[model samples]
Target chain A: MKRIFKIYTPFINAGMQETATYRVNWVFYILGSVLGCFVSYFIWHAVFLSGSGETMNGFSLPQMIVYIFLIFLTSTMIGSDAAWAVGEEVRDGSIAMRLIKPVSYNATFLFQELGNKLLTEMFLVVPLIAGLEIVRTVIVGRVEFSVVNLLIYLCSCVLAYLINFFFNICFGFLAFVIKYLWGANMMKNCIVGFLSGAIIPLSFLPETLGRIFMLLPFASLNYTPVMIYMGVYQGTELLYYIGLQVFWALFFFGLSKLLWVVSVRRLSVQGG
Target chain B: MKHIRRLFRIHRIFVVQELKRMMEYKGDFIVGVIGFLMVQCSNLLFLWIIFNNIPNLLGWSLNEVVFIYGFSLIPKGIDHLFFDNLWAIGHFTVRKGDFDKYLTRPVNTLVHVLFEKLQIDALGELIMGIALVCVSLPQLQIEWSVFKVLLGIAAVFFATFIFTGIKIITASVAFWKKRSGNIIYMVYMFNDFAKYPVTIYNEVIKNLITYIIPFAFTAYFPALYLLTGENPLYNVGMTVLMSLALMSLGVFVWHRGIRAYESAGS
Candidate 1:
C-alpha cells in the first residue's frame, strides 16, 4: 500500500500543479458558476414574487433561494470532466502511454482527478460557498447545522464524487467505438444535468419521474448530498440515501472496470 | 466591386472545402446534429415544465416565450455556421502559434481565419429554430405580409452580425492573453439571457443585457416587435444600429490585436 501510494503521489502533485497554471481559466469558470447561480436565483425570485404564494413546489422564498445556491454548490463539488479527458486520450491513443506505465490507469486518473478537485474545492468552491452562506444567513437567517448532518453530508459528497467519476469513465469508454465523443458527452451532460436535479429540484418533477430519477445513479451525485445538507432526510431515510449513494458508487465503479477491460481488449485486437 | 467578388469567390471555395472535410466523417456529423437537437429538445422540455406550472412567465405566454427562444437560435446558428472558427483562435491557434499561418496569408487575416472552417453542427440549430418558429406561428396570430417577412429577414441578418461581432471581439483577446477561451465561453453563455423576456429579470440585469451586452437586441426586442407589432421601428432600428456598432468595434479590436500580435515560437 505504501509503495502504491508513493507511485500515485507524483501524479497527484503533477495534477495540482497543472491546475494551478490555469489560474485565469479557473477564474472564468468560477465567474460562470456565479453568473449561472444569479440567473437561477433571479428566475426563482421573479416567479415567487409574481405568483400568489408564500411557497411554490413546497419551498418558501428563502428556502428556494438557499436551495438554488446549494444546488450550484453541490454541482461544483461533485461534477467531473474526467470522462472528456479520458475520452480524448483514448481517441488519440495516448492512453497507450498510461497502459505501459507501472501504475493502474484507473487509479492514476482517480488521483489526478482528486488532485484537481481538491484544489478547486479549496480555492474556488469553499470561498464561494462561504460567501454564499453569509448571504444566505443575512437573507434567510441561520441555517440548521448539526455535527451529525455535516459528517453525513461529507460522506455523501465523497460517495457522490466516486459515482460521478465512474459514471464519466463509462462514457469515456465509448471512445473505443466512436470517432468523436463530443455528441455523446453533450448527451450525457444533458441527461445527467436533468436527472441529477442540477437544472431543477427533484421535488418539482412529477412524482413518477422524480421517483425514477431517485433510483438512478445521477441523483446520488447532487440531490442526495444537498438533501442531506438541508435535513430533508433523517434517521433511517438518511441512512438509506447514504447507502444508495454507496451502492451506486460501487455499481458504477464495477461497471466502468468491466467496460474498460472490454474496451482495452478490443483496442488491442484492432491493433490500436 | 471586383475585390468584393473575389472575396465572395474565395469564401465559397473555403466553405466547399469545409463541407467536404465534414462529409468525410458522416457519422460524426450525424451524431453532432442529433446531439444539438437533443440539447434544444431538453431546453424546450424545461420551458414546457415551467409553463406547465405557471401559465405565464411575467406577462408573456408560453408560445411567445418559445417564439423568442426559437428566434434567438437563427442568428446564433448563422454565426456558428460561418464564424465558428473564431473559437479556434482563443482555444488553440494563438496559444499554439498556429496563428502565424493566418498572418502569412495574403488575403485579409480576419476573413481568411473566419472562412477557414464551417461548423455544420449549426445546421441542427438552424433547423430546430425554423421548426419552432413554424410551430408557434399560428399560435402567435401575426398577420403575414411581404413587408413583415422582409423585416423578419432583416432582423435575423442584423442579429447574425451581432453574434459574429461579439465572437470576434472576445476571440481577439487571445492576442494579449494567449488563451481566452474561458472569457469567450462566459460571454457566449450570457446569450442564454436573451432566450427569455427581459422583463422577467430585475432592473439591473435588464439594463446589463439591454445596453451593456446588447443581447436584448439579438432576440427579445425583435420578437416583441414581431409578436405585438408595436415599436417595430425602434426595436428593429436599434438592432441594426447595435449590429453595425458591434461589428465596427469588432473590426477595431481585431486591428488592435493584430498590431499587438507576437507569434508564439515554433
Candidate 2:
C-alpha cells in the first residue's frame, strides 16, 4: 500500500495543479450549481404544496431540501472526468505513449481523479455547500445535523469515491474495444444521475425497488452518504451501510484492475 | 434580395455536405439518439415520480406539465440540431483561432459559422418532444381549432428562433473573452426553469425569466396560452417580440464581436 501511494502521489499532485490551471471555469461551475439548487427547491416546494403539508415517505420538506444539497455535494465528490479523459486518450492513441511508462495506469488515473475531486471539493463544492446551506436554512427551516452523522457521512463518501472512480475506469476501458465512449458515456451518466439518487431520493421509490437499489453499488455513490447525512441510519444500520460501501469499493476496484489488463492488450489506434 | 438568395443557396450546399459527413457515423448517431432519449426519459421519470406522490404541480396536471416539458424540448432540440456549431465558438473556436476560417471564406461569416455542421444527436430530443406532445394532447383537452393549430405551429417555429438568438448572443462573447462557454452554459441552463410552470417560481424568478432572459416565453407562456386561452397578446405575441428582439441583438453583437476579435498568435 505504501509503495502504491509513493508511486501515485506525484501524479495526484500533477493532476491537482492541472485542474487548478482552469480556475476561470470555477465561477460558472458555481453558477450552474445554483440553478440546480433552485430547480430542486422549486420542484420539492411544489410537490409539498400539492400533497399534504407533511413528510412524504420519511423525508420532511427541510430534510428533502438538505438532501438535494447533499446530493450536489456528493455528486461533486464522486464525479470525475477521468473516464471521459481516458476514452479521449484511448481514441486518439495517447494511451500508447503512456503504456511505456513504468507505472500502473489504473492507479495513476485513480489518484489523479482523487486529486481532481479534492480540488473541486475545496474550491467549488465545499464553499457552495456553505452558501447553499444558508439559502437552504432561510428557505426551509433548519434541520439538525449531528456531528456523528457528519463524520460517518464523510467516511462513507471516501468509500463511495473509490466505488465511483473504479466504475468509471472500467467503463472508460470500453473505448479500447469500441473506439468511442461518447454515447456510452452519456448513457452511463443519464442512468447514474437517476440511480445514484442525484435526481430524487431512492426512499421515495416503492419500498421493494428502494431496497433493491440499496443493494446495488450505485447506492454507495450518493444515496448512502446523503442518507447518512440525513441521519436516516445509525448504530448497526450505519455500520452496515459503511460495510456495503467497502464491499462495493473492493468489488469495483478488482473489476477495474481486471479490465485494465485486458484493455491494454486490446488497445488499438485508428489511422496515423 | 440577391444577397439573401446567394446566402440561402450556399447554406443548402453546406447542409448537404454536413448530411454526407453524418452518414459516415451511423452507429454514433443511433447511439447518441438512444442515449439522449434515455436522458430525457430520466427527467420524465423524475416528474412522474413526483406526480405519483401528488396529482398536480401548481394546479397543472401531470399531462399539462408534461406538455410544457415536451414543448420546451422542441425549440431546444431545433437549436441543438442546427446551431450546435455555435457551441464551438464559445468553447474553443475563438481560443483556437478557428474563427479565422469563417472570416477568410467568401460567404458571410455568421452564415458560414451556422451552416457548418448539423448535430444529429438532437434528433432524440426532437423525437421525444413530438412524441410527448402527441401522447399528451388527448389528455390535455384543449379547445382545438384550425386557427389554434396554426397558431401553435407558428409559436413553436418562433420559439426555435428564440433559442438560436440566445445561443448566438452568448456565443459571440467568445470573440471578446476568447472563451465564453461557461457564460453561455449559465445563461442557456435558464431554459430548464422554462420547462416547468412559471407560476411555481417566486415573483423574483418569474420576473427574472420573463424580462431578463425571456425564457418564460419559450415554453411556459405559450403552453399556458395554448392550454388555458390566456392573453394571446402577452403569451404568443411576446414570444414573437422576444425572438425578433433577441435576433437583432444577436446580429448586432456578432458584428461588434467580429470587429473586436483577435486570433490567437500562431
Which has the greatest DockQ? 2
Tens-digit per-residue lDDT, A47-159, candidate 1: 77667778887888777776787778777878888789888887777888899997888889899878887787777656765676677678766764455765677789899
What are the candidates' interface root-mean-square deviations? 1.6, 1.2
Residue runs of model 1 more than 4 Å from their true location after superposition = A141-151, A268-272
Q: What is the lDDT of candidate 1?
A: 0.85
Cα-based TM-score, every candidate: 0.96, 0.96
Candidate 2 vs. true structure, TM-score: 0.96
User: What does candidate 2's lDDT look like per residue over B1-266, in tens digits?
Assistant: 99998888987998899889878888888889999999999999999999999978879899998999999999889989998998899999999998888888787788888888898999999999999988899987799888778878888989898999999999999998899888888888888899999999999989999999999988999988889887888899999999999999999999999999999999
TM-score of 1: 0.96
| Candidate 1 residue-pair clash tally | 0
Structure candidate 2, residue pairs in collision: none
Which ranges in model 2 have alpha carbons more than 4 Å from their true place? A1-6, A135-143, A270-272
Which whole-number lDDT from 0 to 100 does residue A179 have in model 2?
47
* DockQ, every prediction: 0.58, 0.74
